[model samples]
Target chain A: MTAPAPPSVAGARSLVEPVLRDAVARLDPLTARVAGYHLGWSDPYGRPATPGGKALRPALAILSARAAGADVGSCLPAAAAVELVHAFSLLHDDIMDGDRVRRHRPSAWTVFGRSAAMLAGDALLVLAGELLLEQGTRGGVWAARGLAAATQRLIAGQASDLEFEGRPEVSLEECRRMSADKTGSLLACSCSIGAMVAEGPAHLVAALAAFGAQAGLAFQLADDLLGIWGAPEVTGKPVLADLRARKKSLPVVAAITSGTTAGERLAKLLAQPDPLSEPELAEAARLVEEAGGRAWAEAEAEHRLDAAERQLAALDLPRGVREEFGEIIRFIASRDH
Target chain B: MTAPAPPSVAGARSLVEPVLRDAVARLDPLTARVAGYHLGWSDPYGRPATPGGKALRPALAILSARAAGADVGSCLPAAAAVELVHAFSLLHDDIMDGDRVRRHRPSAWTVFGRSAAMLAGDALLVLAGELLLEQGTRGGVWAARGLAAATQRLIAGQASDLEFEGRPEVSLEECRRMSADKTGSLLACSCSIGAMVAEGPAHLVAALAAFGAQAGLAFQLADDLLGIWGAPEVTGKPVLADLRARKKSLPVVAAITSGTTAGERLAKLLAQPDPLSEPELAEAARLVEEAGGRAWAEAEAEHRLDAAERQLAALDLPRGVREEFGEIIRFIASRDH
Candidate 1:
């Protein structure tokens, strides 16, 4: 249905998995167990489980390195580092958000205690920096710097998101900035880090970073849509989960600021003190669609995707590499989970 | 008292505070405000406050660099990074431990909220790595790697500390190992990272690290003693704070494992469910002393100080530098708070 995914997706996972596991193994036993569980590498009892996560960030890193004309293995540390940062952010975010589910399973804080999950997140973050520094090259240092900057932005984005929850008035522009920082920073870093690690030309690295930034925004729009309307089975989340949480996601923000009767109704519903009932959530969803929020998000995502594609097209990469990047971008735009 | 505080302590603080402030300024405004408050540079309202914290780790870093024959200013980044890491750990630990007060004021989480404090801590951690990597030197990479390893051990130590809270029978050796990981690892890194960043010889770095490890254990022993009997005004903590939390600090663990009648009584008293009353806490402190926990801890601190001194004496350094290191070690061993 989605062109079967680019080969680089699976290839990146295979190459980066061992490195990730090894880095996690370096944590203390209890932390390793918690981290391993959160990463979907094992069950609560430490037995193997189906590996979880899309490994999308690492795939982007690997593809960026490939575009730089480096061997696939050249950017392994960078790839692993990006994924580790992503994992770290998710673990902490779940605890802060009080979300009990992640990747279709009980979140780490729900499985392990909050303190343990928090420590595991800290361990992963430290391990990411260690992994990159262990490369012992200037490129490694450069990549580590990039990753750290991105992580800071990601944290700021999350902070803003939490702040938005308590505020009644969140402009769509503010929501978009939050999405860019929360998701786009790491994605852009992931795209450029591999090329940076491979000593790619400056122009190529910048182009890839720009492309990833646009794609990341597109990816966030799709995710926000899923948060509201995605099936529970496909998205590994409850129906209308965002609306239930009163999350000021892009569509919700767009609707709240739409200046229409349906938008006004939706805002009033979200402003209520009690949690929304199932029927109310359904009505809220309908109102968001009726207010043109859903259509706006869809159009914005498409626009971003086109911009991402143009950036990739202008790059002087091999055809296969370009096609691989294109396929991953499209996959992200259409992913159900 | 205790040879009048070492000039290097004040000197290090002066040298590193600006750099530390600069690094924290890079964070988003809200996180930066939280971090600033936690660092004692500002009040909850963002107004300037009297500076807090002893800046001992940064002093160690600066002194270690001096010991390596590098200019005192050369290790500012390493010193600032170590201090940032320490602040990061304290911020998160306060949240995890539910501590309401820190450095004689409300903890960051209490002043702001848990989520904001956590994000601030996360921001600081990322900024620490970024500072080191920004140096763009091979030594910077090496120091970042060392800091990362120490951070992992520190997290492991914290995990063990939390785990020990529920377990009734924690062996003395296990508790000691936990202390080494929790406190010794970072202290050791702080002592050695300066030299590592200055490209000092391996032997010098190793000696500095060993000295720091020994001093760190001694420092923890002293801190555990203070937790039981130190003046609340001086310690900026409630009387018998650790006991109130049922923390398995070294002294408490020693008393519990002492195999004396007093130790048995202390254990029974601790095993009760509700919060310990003030009188009960006082009684428990007396029992710990009667059970020889206090004496044993004092002697162990002395023993560790001797080892630390021997390591420093063997190093090829100027007399003034040696005196400075000696003064700090002595201060650590004798400090009441």
Candidate 2:
């Protein structure tokens, strides 16, 4: 049976953004400015910023709290804390990945200078803990602990990702573990923190985290698809941007290990120090598909999405809350950009 | 009055290093390896590391807790947390400053690669919070909050320092403010967290933080002195390394704005885009001293130390605690490295 239309993402974000903005505001003036600009609360010139970013992590956090039977009001801090952490990672990830653009604008490091952006990211991470400290309930300590653990794993994942980038010997297994740590850990935190804030039963909390982990894997696979095939206008990044950097994205790694002629060609092209030309980059993308990387990623995404769906039955969520979460999972799995 | 031959710093460090090591061990294996190397807990080849840093921050934390009448054993986590934050900053600061050497060894970023070092720093910052969360008392939450606040200020301080580095117009006031935030805030946190963990009275805690702030300023001023005048063998850095970078340290900034002929000469020497030659760098250092920068820094340091001393009467510390702490303060003010 078809599920009813899910709750509005915009609605969920609007509910969570104020709290998130308030937390960001608590930074020292200089950091607040950098974080504000990064969060799209202001432009580089200090004028009010136009709305930007999907507010997806906070939406998940709020939805997770609802699924665990909490009202929006009580769960706001958990949602905001997770969003702050998401922004923190984004700031550092841009620096670590050396990407110059994000969300159709110059990335924070490119505009504010790398050191300032890094410091801003550092401030946001601490701010997340500070905001969580104010929660003052028993769950506050547990929630903060969970966030800390997730952040550590996220850092570990990114470290592994960087380590793999310089090595051609990375296996598919290693790549998947990196993806799970880098992406899944924080998403799981978003869920786990929500449940902790709601005082959800331990089993329910574990189930929600499991759902988030699988959903995150699906999200990364979808992201891998977009990195290759999506339009720049939609993705807000140049087409083949990841390939231009010779990033060992999942599909690319899959193709490299496929033991086929096209795979060998892709591997050789990636080893050069010079920037890949447009035609060469395009051909590289095609070779990945032909090497069965695209098909493998698609199947994996579906498999993860299905696995995520099964975890929902383990939660005693209300009907509407369950439907809304299902819609988000579907969105993550199938989004084009 | 002469501070009665301050307690041995090595003695203090020996008390705190094990706790710090235990916390460092909590990181995931890969990050632990990177952090271990940075901390001198392990070699690059994963062999046992030689004795590393001086454990200064943790010593201060533990001493502050003692100054608040808490036993060293009970305050270990708070001390460890401060040390973690200190290491976190060092890791990121190395990246931001682009320095290749730290503690007389290749910096983590240079040896492990920048992204890995950055991720390791991120992991350390989160680990600081996690260790504090395990404090498990009411003071645990407040102590974590204190650490978070200090961390945010430190980031702001670093951000401003980065901004000042690229501009020629930094005022002594701005430089001093940056020093307070970057250095003083964390020192203050060491004291404040110690007191909070002991559940010290609010006024006493504030007084300790105030003392730490003044002492921190003195510490930075002493550091500035060493940056220019300390022997390479003692400081573990090349002679005139700060001058080579044309850093806007208090002395350097004071020299530039001193309105003397020497100050003008130093400014012109600094304005060149190319690196200064050995003769030019030495001349610049002499010019700074000639412009009265050294004297000003020395006097400022004494003034700050005196101010820090006055805050101690407010503490009502145990009999030996105040004397031991006074010795530590003296040590911070006068140490060559």
Chain A superposition TM-score per model = 0.97, 0.95
User: Largest TM-score belongs to which candidate?
Assistant: 1
User: What interface RMSD do all candidates show, one decimal each?
Assistant: 0.8, 1.2
Lowest lDDT block of 10, candidate 1 chain A: A1-10
Pairs that collide in candidate 2 are none
lDDT of 2 at B329: 75
Docking class of 1: high
Q: Local distance difference test, per candidate?
A: 0.90, 0.83
TM-score of each: 0.97, 0.93
* Over 4 Å off, model 1: A1-5, B1-4
lDDT of 2 at B179: 95
lDDT of 2 at B221: 92
lDDT (tens digit, per residue) of candidate 1 on B149-225: 88888999999998888898899999999999999999999989989999999999999999999999999999998
| Per-residue lDDT of A298 in model 2 | 93
lDDT of 2 by residue, A1-337 (tens): 1232235577767888788788877777777888988988789976897777666677778877777778878878888888888899999999988888888899988888888888889988888887777989877787888888888888888878877777867889999999999899998888667778878788877888898899999988988888888788867889998898777889988998999999998899888878889999999999999999999999999999889888986667876867777788787667653
| Stretches of candidate 2 exceeding 4 Å from the true structure | A1-7, A256-280, B1-8, B256-277
Error of 2 at A332 (Å): 1.9
